[model samples]
Target: MELTINVDETTRNGSLLFKAARTNDTGAMKKLLESSDVDPFIRGNLEETILHTALLNDNKDVMEVIVEMVPSLINEPMTSEMYKGETPLHIAILKQDINMVHYLLQHGADPIHARAIGSCFIPGPYGQCYYGEYVLSFAACLENEEIVTLLLKHGAPLQAQDSLGNTVLHVLVLQPDKEMACFMYDIVTSFVTNKQKHKVQSIENSNGYTPLKLAAAEGDTQMFNYLVQKQKRTYWTMGTISYCVYDLTHIDTWGDHKSVLDIITSSKKMQVRKLVDIRPVKELLHHKWKTFGLKYFMLWMISYIAYTSIFTAVCLYRPLKRMPDNQTDNFTVMIQKTLAESYRTKGDYIRLSGELFTIVGAVVILASEVPYLARIGPRNFFGNASIGGPFPLLMVAFSFSIFIAVIFRLLGMEQESIPLSVALIIGWCNTIYFARGFRMLGQFSIMIQKIIFGDLLQWCCLLFISIIAFSSALYILFQTLDLTNYPYFRDFQMTLYTAVELMMGLIDFPIPYNNVTPSFIYIVYVLYMIFAYLLMLNLLIAMMDDTYWRVAQEREELWKVQIAATILLLEKRIPKFLRHRSGVPGITLGFNDDDKWYFGVEEIIPEEKGKIQAGGIHMAKSVGWEVIRSNLARIANMKEYTESTPF
Candidate 1:
């Protein structure tokens, strides 16, 4: 009797075993394997043997038939192109098929297979990284506890290293995904032995980065803590920390000018520091943030003076002496009493608090800035513009007006400025003072500085020179014209102001001269318009456009430096108790930056290192002036600014 098994036409490229497996036909698979003519171990173009094909397709029935028929084929490594030298067991692991892997291992498959059937490699920064999902790494990558345990039970190599020297534990520790890290942690603590685990943990990749080091560099603080704690390493001794802190670019693992610590610490973000549990680093960052809040609060309080003074002067202003029992017909007086008087409205305490707040803010700002005003001039203070600025002047003005009008309770004055209307003269000054605070950021600071100072300064000089040359000729020529009634040509200041207005298009076009003016005066006016509008104005516009793009390109570096300055300024203010404790079991890391801070033995290089004046609110500009904020751009490396520094 003969057994007939009809295989599908898709078996041309694959074996009958794979075709039957795809269809889940156990009968056909069994018949084909039992027949004498068909070889159970025959391979296709990709070197996928019948057993390999069955495993690849997740065909349970075909896989079962092949395993029973050809026991020798189970562990046979292929010689084909795609998965050369990898056996069927490796194929099962790649598929992450727990049941197939269990069946294969039970049916004489080797457990310690390093070459997983379809494992991959990717080009890293240095060279090829073992990025493939192989055996234990495949199970670990999937975060599959059951498959991992099953593999471990069947004696899979726990210390298996990939081509790039990444151990199974290395693969596990580097995964930033929380679930994967948790599973990897569980595998290390439970499955791997202490001796074997330490050996694998110490294995460094070709780039000389260990698993914990890679985790730290990746800024996966959770993974870093778990792996580092297991190694009994602390903040100071961790490879990632030391590599970053020491600026060890000499080492193979130091990938850039920045270390892992630099990348982590230099970040302006608070959340990055909050997520990690690295002993003293978190404390150090906390102090920086605390100082930031304190500085901002102090500045806000100063600005609040201007706000409250103007608010209360208009809303709560009143004559200290009661209104006279006199005028009944004065309707204007009645309206002023009803609307502008504090007692004339809802709540008295709120208005009183507002007035008091303004006075207190004024006093505080004056106390802080008055002594240093001689050294740090008003221009410098306003241009540092962020924390230290001419906000004091506005506060002082508002406070003086309030005191002069109603007379402060502390002062002995009765009636000085009288109506308090004098204080409201510069009420709009508060908006300018407050608005400049937002300009501390590099984006706005650079853009506004370039436009106002760089381009505007140049344009003003050109306009002044042009107006002088053209206005003089006209003024001398029209000396005899009847310009007595018209102030436009009678006085030089008036002529200058009118000329500026004309240049700015505020005056009529086509040169409006007095009817008595000479004909040569009209020629001078035509030449003036041609030069000012046609050439000079367009030149100014082009120059401003150029300045905008140039500053925009540098905004990122400027921002980084600005952020670093603020942190360095405040980080030094942290006392001993605020820093890491010395007596702990781990080594204490001290943070300092070139005598800027005396706190610690370890220091991070500031983003604007050696660029700012060490101990003052002064950034170093041209001529090494301590406080003068100037946009003197040294154009030495302007062309090379965008080029990569090949180290």
Candidate 2:
């Protein structure tokens, strides 16, 4: 009675069960599926499950019977012996059977459960587990999105990375289908919401590439634009300005210290480069003016004198003008008193008049010299020199004139004195405009090749400077021509005037002007006040913004260097035992086969070398490794490898 099943008998029994299921023999398949005497997860010779064989053969009746008999087996882990451990679900997905996938999903098959098939037969590396085979890769391999959606709805993690480090979004970015990518986004959103957890929006692959970066690298402009806009709004709060500050020890979500902005800026792709170059031109202009010119000199002088004169005049004259004369003041005493008051007033007026004359004198000198300096003729009016040579001299003269005017105006001049204050303010304003114009022209000279005929970046910078200069000059001229009388100027002046008057109306004083209407004088005063305030404030703010961005860019570069260093360190520190086994013929060097072996370190090092250590062997080895790794990693990670490989 010691009956034992032989190998032949076992094989025959399994074959009979698989054949019955494949041929839609529901009665036999159900008997086999419900048999307690057999292993429910068993597979036949083709490494196919009875259920998998039924699905492959399109035996819907057998599949339905199996599902009805053992619903738990619908999501059961397949036996390890069949097809090197691939689950029944994996087999159905690989066969491209939408109906089988739907049935399996409906019956509770886990799409996210990965099985480890042999490396020789697996689409990716051995032990590779993707989110689901239903997601297409870059090769346009077909996948069922509807089924994937169903799995995702049932609590599947869309952001779960495969062995190759690609999420559903990552895979969709590689595909050419727009609808697929949008659908993937929706699925990911649902996964996030369902899980009540926030996944990293920009997850990198094994090769350290985010979905956006991949799109950018592939030149998928439409997808790249959409992702950038979406991410920027979501993460950066739609701020028009952004800065990347780098620290050597600061690691990003990808375990590197390099800033995303830096990576984008240095990318060889033109689109990424263009996006990173969108810096604020106004800020740069502020830094340039502050660092390299007479602009600051003029500004300092104007501020110092304007503040001192306005303050001193108000303090000294306010109480005196309001004082009353006593009856004790006799005719001679009254006359003497009157004479003294007139003398004091006349002295104040004379001092202001002198300052006004000095400012006007400087303006006249500058206007006269500009024509001479700008004139290009055989006879050198400014001397035997090119226009370039005398240009600097004119700038110096303009700067000096501004200094002189500012100094005189600060000597306690009254704000209400029409002739002197008007002349002085107008002259200083003109000088500022001329100086700025000349400086800009000089900048144009230096960057002429770039601005007029070179790349778009320089052209843009030039265009920005031109716009600012033109607008500022127009404003100055508008003030000078007494055009506040015109409807447009009146309206323009009113906006700024109204704002200022509302803020400082209580402290304001009346101007002494009989010829010009009070309304016209009021408009002129408001125009100057607003112009000075806005110009100075805006320029300061711009300078600060430029400095911040410059520092940020520098920091970003440093961070990148640190990241590269860390990677190099890791590469070097990789124990020889753990290094990738070389498959190349001959010498068993761990280095990539295509790497050029050079004797000099300078030719191969990943980093810069000192004066004396440029040709060291260690540098050469390190550089060779970096070059080889970068190239090979890209090739090894590409989707083409999976499609082209026999596996």
Candidate 3:
């Protein structure tokens, strides 16, 4: 009869072979492997290999013993559901056991191809393992240069990507260790050939982030600079005139068609603060605006002018109306009178032309918004008021008003003028949208809009409350007085009107001495002035001043955000054939053989090429880099090179 050997629950599920492996009991492991019932390769509940179980207890001797008994277990992977595809080498590197790692590599362990894709490596809510899924990546993440060098020496492929398509360099940026990232970046660049380096640098991960682009998204400036420096090739350096060609594909859009700019300029994520504060990104945008943005903006402006002018002409040249004879004329008779008078008027040709053009303009403006609505999604298009400015909202109102006015005019309703007046006001105000084309005017326009919506809106709320309070108090105080004594305060409506007029400095003293006490009336008048004019008005001025300085500081960045939005919107309107007709901005960076659709080149003088560390991140300062892009030859003679400089 066989009696069960009761073991501690801690000893790997009480399996004798696993227990022997964990405790470094080579004799027990040998006896267990020899048993017909016990298989050395049998996986327990967690599916850990015997080698894996020995490594867990740092039992290199047990690992060697097991390997000698069943040499196949040396490279055997953990076939468990949770830790599938994890090899002994991957376990050694993760354990940071350099001796074990050496032993595994010496025994012909597959370092490059064997990916550890266990539950431990997958990112999730509880915690994340940011390292790529390979032994080389695991060693690099640990920053154990000895193990990394050993793995590389043992012929680990430098260009290998893990389960998420992230190369070791891509994984380094996502880690919080900047020094390790920089050190590994230097190592990778030095070890690889130029062609291999470009492949490693430009290959985007599953989330569409290259190593450099990932650094930008992670806001790791030091790592970003180190990566940027590695990719740059000094084309010609003659004293002060040095032209270094950067790989435009470094910052180019990834497989998802999302560029570095798209990630950094996201308002919802507030990533502008993360990366746009860097100098190269700013110059890149400035270069893009100069190259193709100015022309598109001018076209949008000219179209807007025509749109507004047509609507204005329609209102200005409306047919003249004759007054109805009696004030109490029936609605049908009034409509007939208005139609007859409008038909009898001269200048019918001008009126008809204006009306036709106005209809076309309103329809065009309404239709143009559909693209913007679709591109940004309804939440962002409506929520982010700064992007579209007030123009989108005003255009919508103006279009609706124009449609209503046109319908009323056709129906012979005299109220057509009411909606027309609203459209005319909104149409003129909508011109502020074009102000963004000019730098100074654009920032100033943003400031004014900010003040109106922020400070002025709050002031209006306070003003309303004060008015209602004072108006009620004064109405009750002056109720017994006759109209002859205090006509402005005799009724509740009149009292409210008088209160508003007093606030505006449009009314004089109107306190009556008949019913209300002179002192109380005087006190009320003084209190109204103090609360509404002195306090509220002055507070509004101070609030505006605060908003002005605040907006002034961020005006340039704010203006650039609007410009980015403009570029995205304008590109949507351009026909793809015409957009790609000139080989200007688009070029093939030979890394992946894919043409970069959005990119720019930065030119920097050698004297100003030194890197500046900003908030512990390296960036360029002092007119860092002036970005320029045109035909490939004019920017850089080589099609393979795309440049981004220090600043």
Strongest candidate by TM-score: 3
Better of 2 and 3 by lDDT: 3
How does each model score on lDDT?
A: 0.53, 0.44, 0.69
Question: Cα-based RMSD of the predictions, in order?
Answer: 24.7, 25.8, 8.8
For residue 220, give model 2's deviation from the true position in Å.
Answer: 3.9
Worst 10 residues of 1 by lDDT: 631-640
Tens-digit per-residue lDDT, 109-222, candidate 2: 765555433343334555243332322221112445565555566655655676567666776776667666755565555546422322444577776766766665565666
| lDDT, candidate 3, 131-199, per-residue tens | 688888888888888888888888887778877888888888777788887787676566777667767
> Candidate 2: deviation at residue 65, Å?
2.2
lDDT of 1 by residue, 576-629 (tens): 233321111111112121211111123243244233332121111212332112
Q: Which candidate do you rate higher for TM-score, 1 or 2?
A: 1
Judge candidate 2 at residue 539 and give its lDDT: 54
In model 1, which runs have C-alpha deviations exceeding 4 angstroms? 1-14, 24-31, 34-36, 77-87, 94-96, 117-132, 173-176, 225-280, 284-647
lDDT at 130, model 1:
40
Which segments of candidate 3 are over 4 A away from where they belong? 1-22, 36-50, 70-87, 105-125, 145-165, 189-202, 250-257, 267-284, 295-299, 327-346, 382-401, 407-422, 447-549, 564-568, 571-647
Comparison by TM-score, 1 against 3, better one: 3
Off by over 4 Å in 2: 1-5, 33-40, 70-72, 76-85, 91-102, 115-145, 176-179, 190-200, 217-219, 232-260, 265-647
